[model samples]
Target: MTTDCSSVAYFSMEIALDPALPTYSGGLGVLAGDMLRAAADLGVSMVGIALVQRKGYFDQHLDDLGNQSESPTAWEPEKVVEPMLPVVTVRIEGRDVRVRAWRFLIKGLGGHVVPVYLLDTALPENSPWEQKLTDSLYGGDAHYRLCQEMVLGLGGVAILPELGHSLISSYHMNEGHSALLTLGLLEERLEGRALSSATEEDIHAIRAKCVFTTHTPVPAGQDQFPHDLVSRVLGEERTAALEVTGACPAGSLNMTYLALFGSRYINGVAMQHGEVSRGMFPNYPIRAITNGVHAVTWMSPAFGDLFDRHIPEWRHDNLYLRYAIGIGTSEIREAHVQAKRRMVAELKQRTGVQLDEKVLTIGFARRAATYKRADLIFRNLDRLRWIATHCGPIQIVFGGKAHPSDVGGKDLIRRIFESAAALKDVIKVVYIENYDWRVAPLLYAGADLWLNTPQRPQEASGTSGMKAALNGVPSFSVMDGWWVEGCLEGITGWAIGHGPESPDDEVFEIAALYDKLEMIILPMFYGRPTAYAEVMRSAIAINGSFFNTQRMLSQYLANAYFRPAVA
Candidate 1:
């Protein structure tokens, strides 16, 4: 499929188009995939560029002691994608590194296709070390990561003309990983003119053609390379030019700073994230385009059937999800029960632990990062046992994988297993291993409630809860990320703390979590079936309708993508 140059060229280091692809690490890639799916559904002119991970992100394996280990996740690219001939090359460390591309077409509801071109460095023309650049997703040390970024940013832009996508109107840097694309654009501007003639007008001209989305609130999450390292990798002259233009500060080559300096439009993935980002970079103007999921992709089969019968237009327009409020209470309950039964069977099949279909099932899955506070619920084991044994029979399902280097994150997983052992007799706890896109939908659709407990302001935008909402699963989370916008006290779901400002104290939040579950959530769930179903209906209607990529992509088109091209 050929794309016109007027299409939006979305550049990211990873793209999680499908679970089997393993070209993604976590939320960022998943969000990108969802956006592309929505773009196809809406028929927006678009194309995606990302690195083709050969070995892919590592597969998660746990020892008997619950220590996390990783092995290469293997898959055949030919099974899902076709290779594009005529390799492109980018200068790296004063050497030419040849890059190739693979095409994966994502078909949408109306049969519209969005072509995603994944760039790969593994080729016969490249050296052994150069070939290894694209071997794994988010692998290697700082130097390796920087080179991967170069291939994705600089090389991605260089290949567009060769791939027949040279007429791109706007370049979107999904994150700082692909910020180097700006440098390539800058180089193009300085081609005929003398380097000394480069002015602020030239910088502004390039900035007008690009937009950026910053995903993390944490300081360390952004990439920053040392000056010497950057000088060595990217030639000293080019590095000096970047410094002269104020793209790279004196100390180091801060990727996020470079992206901010180069892009005309900048946005955060959530409302709170937008505010936090602005605070982090007080000098820059940052806007919010909250993250959303592809509704049809995440809706459970049972719910899909239900929606098809009751609200047939939901698949076409997500705003039709608002009609979920008209669905009968019994019908909603039955659909959820069907989804729960399927999940229970799958869980038993995988882990040999039979979960009770009637019991309150809670799901918590995402990257096993420490800021996510995956172990917050297990903070007070005695209180948790009390809630499980005395208040209600509840089961907690955990799914996630920590990065190979994140020891603290792995420790969080180990602690969850330890807590499971301690509370084995009281409540059933199972940590699902190797969580990926295939298993995510089951957990989201099957669970009685979706749980998220991130430290306040740390979460950029948690789309997992939004996916759960699409399946009529109400969230019980802290007042953070999109939850601040989605939560409706007792209507959609319950909040952990009193509100957004309800103190960042862990003990206080945990106590509030227990109090809400024991007092409001459990009573309504066990004693009042009608009330519970109402909450489920509201979750779909209120959260799912608004927190969807249909709206998000439209916002991007209006606010970012379709802005007039630079003169």
Candidate 2:
């Protein structure tokens, strides 16, 4: 599929494009990076705008005591992205704000230039309040976060005009974080005209040009600032202009509200999430566009090579991606086992994480959020003991960081750490600190089984589990998010959330998940470790065929953007 609208500008508060690019921290960042890569590969003109942090996010370090610590790291613009260019200046509230935006090259990836422009608030012209906008992701106080979102939304909208680009293209808001772009666009339309003089058609047309994609189903996951707080940040003039029917609410500007009202198209990240979103916002119209990963970025050379041979044209056809299954060949299977063995050995030595290469290793990692149920395994201490004592040893390695100021999230991290320390040796738990892309490949390549259990419909689309599957690591996940579509029972991995709609309604969902863990997971690890290893190999082969980013990107092109062009 192709589109006539060749250029697209994607606005997001954060994009986990790559480690070299510190604008993103987790899932949203990964998704943004995937979009950037897809735009390049598909030859779709695209630009990414993100904040330039003087403090390029916090390096979350876990102290020896298992408490999480934060350290600020800054990236040199010249060193971060090659060939730094001229700085662009934009006016924000009667002030000339100088922002340095840079372009990055994704090497080894042969594709069109997908320019990623970052706004640096560290410049001399930036006010202290403006500079504060580039603070850490999911960090600082609530009011501070709103200011940062404004920089991303309003400042980001002004970026294109500053770059000399015409406002004829569509913008994809990754989430509510970039909703301000819509307001900014509306403000541009006003152009000294009185609000009463503006036509409804003009407002609707401005909205039609914007699309909002919501990634979180959980209410708490969504950003909701106090109405009074928004007025404080954006000021009366701008805030009044944004109010519905010209009456500004004392409450914060609902990012979701702005996105919904300002966008002609709104979508959720996964099918379930779409349904959840529709239910969550019954008054608003929204559809689902499931999130996906980038096959090129995720596929390991060893595993990806299989597809290069089976589908020789995949190399040339940037969209051609097979999940990279090494089946019907004993040699390839052995190679996979050896790779897993090597990864485990290295992790065991480096992180001082004790593990049996013979014991089935499970990998669980993500942001330390309570809704994600990072501490699910610990919910059943007795079950853990059973696995440790009677069952062949099973180990789970966890890693991720909480927002610096998220005290609850910090406590969750501490809980996981304590559990890890308690279940030493037999049921070892290694929570790696300072997780970055450099170490991510190791986790994906190393795990025997990738475990994901978010509350049903809570997970948007877990690409981390998908990444593991590409590497031949089977998964055990709740029937939520992308897993609802990805799980191939008794084959790739196990699925939970089967018993009831609510995991809280009946203890059954938890029971089922644990039952599968104890009965299926434990046995595989202990009963016939070698045979289970074969299951891992087969699981990757199966998933690699279907869920690879190539297929996902193609779907988005056909269903979302390109189809409209073809029509």
Candidate 3:
């Protein structure tokens, strides 16, 4: 299980390898951790790089009115990760700042391990201001974010050699956050050459050694720093050289643009996202590779045992999950029920909400962003109350956190609370506080249906629904993100509308959501138990088998990593 020195060096801003490690804010970091875990399982030669958030991503709390509050996450990284002896330095604002690293070994099912190196800027030798650079995840101003990215990109590249990974043939930028690594590569190429000038051949050579994955489709999601800031942070000479090579444009240093220019292979996380990205950056070539979840990590213990008994090969080869259809419907129902009971008990313990296990439980847990439409289900409260009274008894489990700065996201949470109170007599609703890695699995496995309603195309590649599928829970989502491909109407799960192309898309989608729940979903759950279980089995067999990191890593191996590096 030892990786080759010439393995792919995967760089991301954060890595959520474990619940105890709060280095991740949301899906992107979780996805990075899953990718590494799968890479280890399949023996894909790779090492991951990220920043060690000492203060960690903030702990989420909410008031009685659903007003969000933030608190520092207290955890000891030394307790979880092994510290490496070597220290590297990268210049920031004309001053040399020292960087250290810690390694967390992610052991896969096959006894293979992938080492994730977390770069840290907190040291006694470094200035007090520099020491606090690695203090928080997605905290601080734009300058602070730029510095953190530098520690991950420049410092990560520098320390790899010190950690005996000098021969890394390719660098994979998981997102634009780590695009500065390309600059480190460029500097290495320009060694013994003029710093003010860079040849096309040098740029081409660096591009050949790199790959980039863009997760966000919207313009605001892309990180863009002013050119003056880039010059101040990374030296004026280096900035001028980067401009010469077309990595940093004239006005601003667009991180996504830099990555696109420096990478030979660039991809979006989903098929629709790829098309959207091509429209955004028509000049560059971009391919689509739909994202996937790590099956073993996401599967509930109850379903895990079920899969172990039925689809034994699922651990090593997730494609074997397709055999889940062979498992009896009764067995699937029992497993799902057991998982639901467990989640109910946990939710009761945490939030004091004793949800009915027999009721049709709907789960909606993701980043509480405006476009995610957390309040979409409650748009027509009168219709919702009618459905609850006539169709069936239902309970909802809401779990997610809004960014401290996003007032709109926090307002959505407040709206949900208000709706929950308004419908308290008709249906039960519970909003779980501090939605993290620990809470995500419980909600995914416990709920009868996983709900996702994003404003089309905004959701790049959501994997929460995929996790629910592994646990025998069907999704009720919009035709966006990975759901665009994973959704198989009335089979695996239900779709809200076709796509976002319709002029009355929102009207159509909300109506469809109500109609499906009232007419189909609730009736099937309460009346036809065997039929409901069959759909659950199909979810595991079809969506769970295909939407997994095992398949995704293989695609990367053939299409990106294994491609010959340029000289």
Candidate 4:
């Protein structure tokens, strides 16, 4: 079945369609990109709206002293890293903002005409700071971040009408950043009408055509600002026009809350996350629409060719499995080893570090946030030393970035860095600076085992593990996010946490789990070669069928989009 919806506009703060586009920071962006790619492949008529930055996010550079330094990024037209398309100008907030939106005319992808519109705030007329808005994927200052989101949400709402495209069949808010678009639509409906005449029915109709998807279960990531503060940033009249909750602390309206109240359909990224989200937003009815990745775009082409040849059943039924099957067992294992060796070599060349290849190589890469427990391995220095020095030596390769203004997260990075320097060789820890979309594929493709020790329930849908699993790398993670669904007991990976909550008694549980891992997990990895291979094989087989973009998109069509349409 093919879809011919007039148009579906997808809104997000980032996109990871290609590694060359450093506009993505982590999983959320990558998922957004996968959605667009899959939509194009499925012919699910849609257009993606995203911010086009000047710098397109931070450029990480290590100082001579090995300290990370970040500054305002200026993107040259020639180095924009995207193909050109005719731009369209729109009036957003009383200003003529020129945005460079692109139309992707995909072939053999069925009916969907996917056009991704990139809004540029870097026009000649824009202020210097405004021009710099597009510099990094996640830019500076709380105010600047709010301003960027405003442009994304409110300004984005104005773009469609201004572009003379009125047949918006549906609006999909990828995350909270796009919630304000719903508000803009509300304002448009009540342009000349009085508040007394605006009924809940009116609000329902506006939201009926919209769907909001939440990616993170963590509170901090959902976006909460003092209502008065946000009102000051966005005029009171406009705020009132949108019907944002004024009951929040300090009159603040949480963007996620607004998204929940403003949209007819709301979803979380994973099954467990969905359950947690329903509880998180107790007042509303939230549901789950687990995220997935596009197979053709991410899988190695050789793997695709292989799947089409051998696994014909999986080829059509499970998009990810079809591609993964292409990778012969030997070929996958050898590629993983080679990628890790190369990554280790690259780290040595870049950071002036050296180490033996025999050491158990463990990878930990993600945003330098506290809940992620990026410093879990260093929980017990002495035990870690014994494991590294006495038992088979273990080496950790770390890479990630904190928002430029997140002092706490940055301090965490520094703390981890110091710990790495102390460990030196036996437990060698090397952080590859400037983490972005480009660096992500390398980390996932190279690591022997992906280590994710986030405080349970904090992680939404950690797709990095999926990427790593695809390359035949086993995972060592907490029992949260997508891992809960992907992990097979003693097969695909290991889990530390029992579930989402880390009770007071189990505060040291992950730490204890790692200790066990140091003694048992590390040894099992080295001693049981055949078992390890089987585990790796199982992970790809399981996740390749379950956690794929095509499957997720198909479900979405049958359950969310098409079901609603037929009803």
- The residue-by-residue lDDT of candidate 3 on 1-567, one tens digit each, is 233474799999988889888889999999999999999999777889998999988999999999999999968778888989899899899999999889898887778778889888889999999999988999999899999888888998989988878788789999999998988887777875776567778778888889999999998898888888888998888788667645555588888988998899999999989998999989888988899999988899999999889878889999999999999999999988889889999999999988999999999999999999989999999999999999999999998999999999999999999999999998999999999999789888989999999987899999999999998899999989999888889899999977645554888889999999999999999999899999999999999999999999898888888775332
TM-score-best of 1 and 2 = 1
Say which prediction, candidate 1 or candidate 4, comes out ahead on lDDT.
Answer: 1
Q: Write the per-residue lDDT of candidate 1 for residues 195-230, one digit (tens) a residue.
A: 456788988888888999999898889998888889
TM-score for each candidate, following the candidate numbering: 0.98, 0.90, 0.97, 0.87
Kindly report which residue stretches of model 2 are placed more than 4 angstroms away from their true locations once superposed.
Answer: 1-6, 82-96, 245-250, 314-326, 329-332, 499-506, 525-534, 562-567
Clashing residue pairs for model 1? 5-167
* CA lDDT, every model vs. true structure: 0.89, 0.70, 0.90, 0.69
Off by over 4 Å in 4: 1-6, 63-66, 77-113, 124-137, 140-143, 161-165, 190-196, 243-249, 300-332, 352-358, 501-507, 565-567
- Flag clash pairs in model 2: 15-29, 16-29, 226-252, 227-250, 227-251, 227-252, 228-250, 228-251, 323-544
- Which of candidates 2 and 3 reaches a greater lDDT? 3
Pick out the ten consecutive residues of candidate 2 with the lowest summed lDDT.
558-567
Cα TM-score of candidate 4: 0.87
TM-score, model 3 to reference: 0.97
What lDDT is obtained when candidate 4 is compared to the true structure?
A: 0.69
- Runs in model 1 lying further than 4 Å from the true structure: 1-3, 192-197, 564-567
Residue 63 of model 1 has an lDDT of 73
lDDT of 2 by residue, 1-567 (tens): 112223578887777667675677877787788777766776766678777665766788887667888888666766766433456544454456566566564433564666676766766677777666675666788777776777777777766665645544677888888877877777678886765456788787687677778887776666777767666666666666678632233465667777877776677877777888899878667777666667667766766676666655554453333333435445445556665676677677768765666666778878877678888778877777775677666778888888877787899889988887777745778888877676777778677778887766678777888778766778888888888777778777888758225555326666877788777877866676566666666666666555655565566555554333220
- Give the per-residue lDDT of model 4 (tens digit) for 1-567: 112334677889987656665556677888888877777776676777787665766766665334667865454544543444434443334445555443333332555456665666676767676665556666566666667777787677766655545677678898888787876677668886754466887788777878888887878776766555566676656667544343244466677877877777778888889988988878766778777766555554333455566565553356446345445666556655666676667777766877556656788888887788788778677777777776576778888877766777777787787787777755777788777665566666666788988777778888778777765677888888888788776778887757555453245664666665766677777887656766666767777667777788777666655445321
